[model samples]
Each structure stands twice: as C-alpha cells, then as structure tokens.
Target: MSRAQPPIAVLVALSAVGPLALNMFVPSMPGLAATFAADYGTVQLTLSLYLIGLAVSQLAYGPLSDRFGRRPLMLAGIGLFLVGTLIALLAQSIGMLIVGRLVQAIGGCAGLVLSRAAVRDLFDRERSASVIATITMVMVVAPMVAPLIGGYLDQWFGWRANFWLVGAFAVVVLGFAVPLLHETNHYRQPLPGLSGMIGSYAILLRSPVYRAHIALIGFASGAFFAFLGAAPFVVIDLMGHPPSDYGRWFALGAAGYMAGNFASSRLAVRVGLCRLIQAGMGFMAAGAALMLTLALAGQMTLLALFGPMAMIAIGNGLVLPSGNAGALSVDRRRAGAASGLSGFMQMGLGAGISTLAGHLVVDSALPLAAIMAVSVAISLLAFHALRRANRQARELAARTRPALPKAA
Candidate 1:
C-alpha cells in the first residue's frame, strides 16, 4: 500500500508474462501430442482451455482487486503461474499438461487485468492510454520472439525446457514484485459478496458508452485472432509454402503492430483517444479490403496474406489501448471491473472468431479475409455509435448541469 507506483519496466514485465507463456509452448504442441500418445483434439485442449481460463479469471480478478488490492492479487497470480509452470514441467500425460496450462492462464491473466487497472488508478484517461500504449509496445516483443525461442528449446532440449524458462521468469518477476509492487487502488469499495460484485458489473453494462468501448475492443482484436487461426493453413496448405515461411512472414505483422503501438504511445495525449480510434479503424478497413481483394483475384502469395494482416495488426495496436483506456474511464470507482470486462470480451470474441476461422479456411484465404473485414466493420460501427452516444450524453449533461452564479 505504498504511495509510490510501480515503474513502467516492472509493469511491462508483469504484463509480458501472460502473452510470453501463451505463445512459447505453441511450437511444442505437436511433439507434446506425440509424447503423450494423444489425439490432436485432446492435445489442443492445452491451448483452448488456457484461453478459457484467461477469459474467466479476468471476470473474477477485476472485482476482487477492487475489493481487496492489486499488489496482493498480483503476487498471488505470479505465484500461481510459477506453480502451474512447475506442474507442466513435470507432466506425465496430456491431461496433466492441459490442467497446468489452464492454471497458468488463470494466474497469468491477473497481470493483464490488473496492470491496466493500476494505470487507470494512477492516471487520467488520455495519460492512461499513453502509458498503456507504451507498455504494449514494449511487451509486444515478448510474443514476437516467443515462438522462436520455443522452437529452439523444443528442438534442443524438448518441450519441458519451455516450462523451465517460463518458471524462472515467473520467479524473477515475483522477486522484484514482492518489494516493488504497491497497491494502486486507493479507493477500495465494499462488496456485499457475490451479488454485489455482479451489481458492479451490471452498473457498467448499463452504460451504452461502456458497451460501445467493449465492442470496439472486442471486434477490433478479433480481426487479429481470426488471422492467427487461419493464416497458417492459408500460407502452408493452399500456397504450398514451408512452415518456416509462415514464421518468417509473421514477423511483418508483429512489426506493424509494434509500430502502431509506438505511435499511440507518442500521440495519444496529443491526438486524443477518439481521433486515434477512428484512424485505427480506417487502417483496419483498408487492410481488410486489400486482403479480400487479393484473395478474390486468385493471388495467394505470402505477401498477399501477411501484408494486409500487418496493416490490421497496426490498426489493432491503435485501437486496443485507446479503447481500453476509454472503458476504464467509464467509472473510476469500478475501473478494475471495467478493465476486466473489456479483457474478457476481447478474449472471448477472439476465441470465437479464431475458432470459426480455423474451421472455414480450408480451401482458400477468402474466408479469413472476409472474417477480418467483417470484424473491422463491426468495430468501426461501434466507434461511431460510441461517438454519437457521447454527444447525446454531453447534451443531456449540459442541459441538466446547474449554471454557475453570476457573482464573482
């Protein structure tokens, strides 16, 4: 409960753990299935269940942090992540590995939810957007290199090495966090148990502007998820490219996203969140149009697939931070809940869109491009709807708010 806030580097480190752990083990999935003598569907549970855990856990963490504190929940989350890593490292069956991953996700997402909440607690909306963009831009490197490191580890020492490395990382973060991390939620509210927590969420959900922000965040990120799910098959299967090519070209998408985040970090305070969001949706629309146009033209090259995806990534970078900052600003007292709800929607929608893309992208990349296009369209609509609602709300407030007395 110290007055000092955690440093940006510490916040970045805390946030990176979740995404790093999520991607690092991906290269080991096939090998893991072989080792466990399990079917592909069963082995895939490790990932799908992890996503479920991340989404569900955020719902609980937000309200709990509002009631308890951020620092303690953060420490507990990292501790659980380490414990889960240990469990995965020693797993004897696919079932055990699946369970470990779920646990890891539950713990890791605490950082994802609380880090934003902490930023919201400490700063106003625009500044919070700037800080969040900076944090995201820095931490983007974690997922960018995760699969590369995981590939090497899985090739050299087997999949267990991935868990060992992640566990060590968790330990280091926990060590630094124990003394450095302080409670950022200065205004802790009372929750009369489960019903009260639900009521807090209900209050947030009742706000049209809040729901609009969530839609903007969810659908915007869902475009990226759809690409992640289907782009691999379109690149490797339909285009007849090597698996390595997919990884190589994927870097372009990551770089574009990083660039966009860096732009947001620098421009959020100056350009304003709403304008940035509109510009972001513009980029996404252009990207999706390019993707679909190329697919329909019978051009299935790697560039045709990843090039537009890179543009969409850039849009995602712009939208996510601004949308999150807006959502968190809705009700400062329930900032934690707002952050958590937004994260949940983002994850849940991404999961659904990605899964659907996976099933539909069998023959061509057209389906993938279409899905991205639709997702971006929805996000743009949400952004406009939110803007209109804000104007109306302002008008109402201006009419109702009392005028100041003329006496000086």
Candidate 2:
C-alpha cells in the first residue's frame, strides 16, 4: 500500500457506483417510461442489460488489473463511465438509453471490481474482511437513500438529472483516486493473452473452496436482486404508492443491511469467517420463514413484505464481505481474478433471479416472498457444503504434513 494511500471511504465510494447507479435510477423508471414512450419491461431492460454488461466487463478488468496495475485501468473505466452517462443524459429514446446504460455498466464495473480487489491487495485476509464490511456498511448508504434523492431529482430536474448526479460523483471519485489511490499489486505478472486468461479462470473454477464461496454469495445476493426487480412494481404498481414512498420502505430494509455490516466489521476476526457466514444464513432462513408465513396467512401487506426483507439484507451484509475474503483467500496471488469472478457470479445470478421475478407478474407479494425464501434456503445449503469441503481439505492437509521424525 502507498504511504499516502487514500482512505477506505474512497474505496467505499468507488465500490458504491454499481448500486448507487442502479438504485438511484429505479425511482425514475416510471418517469423514464413516460418520457421515452416505452413500456415498463422495455425501461426495465436498462437495469438488466446494464447488469449483464457489468458482469462480462468485470471478468476482463480483473485480469487486466493483475497485468497492468489497478490505477490506470480504473481511470480508464471512470472515463468510459462518464461517456456513457453523458450519452444517456442526452438520449432522446429508449434504445439510446439502453445502449448508453450498457456502456455505462461496462464502465462502472471497473470501480466495483477493483475496489474490492484493492482491499485484498492492501490487507491480510481477516483484516480485509473487516474493512470490506465497514466499507459496505458505509457504501450501502448510497443505495439506501439514492431513490429518495433520485425521486426528488426526477420530480424537480427530470430523469436525466439522475445520470448527471452519477457523472458528478464519478468525477469527484476520479479526482481523489488520481491523487491518493495506491498500487497494491506488488507482483506484476504480464497481462495474459486470451488462452492464458482462460487458463486463469479454469484454475479458479477448479478450486472447491473458491466455488463454494461463489455459490453462497450468488444465491444470497440473488434473493436481494429478486426484490429489487419486483419491488418497484409491487410497491408503486400494485399497491399504488408513489415512487417516493418506495424510498422510505427501502430505507428500513437498508437499515437491516447496515446493522449486519456493523456486526461483521466488529466481529469478523474474532468470530471467524465461516461462523459468521453460518450465522448470517441462519438470519436469512429466519427472515424468509417469517415472510413465507405471513404470505401464506394472507397478510401480504407492505410491512409484511419489506419488513422481512430487512432481515435478509442483514444476512447479506454478514455473508458477503466474509465470502469475498474467503474466495480471495483461496487464490491470494490472483485476488483480482477471484474478486472479479465472484462479482460476476453475484451479478450474473442476480440478473437471472431478477429477470425471473419480473416475468412472474404476480398480483400479490406471495410470489416474491416465495422466491426470496427459496433463494436464501439454497444459499444455506451451499454454505454447509462449503463448510464440509473446507473441513475435509483441512484434515487432508494435516494428515499429509511431513512428520517431525526424531527431535534433533
């Protein structure tokens, strides 16, 4: 790490681009549809397509960072993101909006992947997890209140102003990142060619420990994405609340997420990663169960829906930082690649879950609750399997350790 390195707040700001972009724009979707004369599904494509672009681009940026160092590539990413944001700000049609958003996703992904990699680059695994937890807790505030700000922005300045805000934030981050960002990749490997990059991915895919962490995060995050996809329609469309109201409901859930991150930051090293993840899964299961019970009992009101969601958010905060560190731990030499791959998995699964949730087209909250429940339950199963695999690997390594022979 550089002596004059930037604070973790900078990293938090950088990593927050994805969610901030996503959440801030959500409140404006109805307005966007009205502006471009498009349908809800068409407008929603901006989010889904952006996530797809983000997933694919991060896969490449990780290795590129490993080869070129984090600073230059990150700056390039910020530049591209601004370009896309400008394009969207000036867009006159839905097609143009989606095109700009796709480009923007590819650009914004740089910060999201690199920020996590930067933490791993600078700190030990345990401390990295704690720092990540703290960063996430703070960064989450972006998504937490973004819709509120964005709602007012839409009402006052029009939807294009949301992109303007995104651009402004990126510019500020770039200013700081240039002056204070440090290079953490001490061992510079030559940038891999196509085949070499594939080989690197192959190696990560072969690690059971790495894959387990990926699976756990993928499903845990999927549940949240499913909610993000469905909530606008549920709250604004079905329940007939204004877009501004969704922001208030979302904050309650975000508070839960923030609480969990606080706990993870405080207890990650002492409680250990695996235990924290397990406890998080337990929280998820409990929340999902509560949601399911309410839905089945015909109590599928707004409180019934989002209240339980807060609990799941809490679990995600606990599991995600620990999971990211665990995945990177399995391949410290390739922390960039691991972080990218895991992020891709998280977003890719999120995209799929959200897409499905959209297509479900439910008149009630029961369907959404059911999907979230199932998703979290599956995440729990993945964690247990990972736990067992880790235990076996540890025992095998212990047995294979070289005997001390006779004391010299």
What lDDT would each prediction earn against the true structure? 0.86, 0.87
lDDT tens digits, residue span 265-344, model 1: 99999999998898888889999999999989988888898899899889888988999999999999999888888888
What TM value does model 1 have? 0.93
Q: RMSD, each candidate, Å?
A: 2.2, 1.5
Residue pairs whose backbone atoms clash in candidate 1: none
Candidate 2: list runs displaced more than 4 Å: 1-4
Candidate 2 per-residue C-alpha lDDT over 298-381 given as tens digits, one digit per residue, 9 for 90 to 100: 885779888899999999999999999899889888888888899899888888888777768568777888889889988988
Error of 2 at 330 (Å): 0.3
TM per model? Answer: 0.93, 0.97
User: Total backbone clashes of model 1?
Assistant: 0
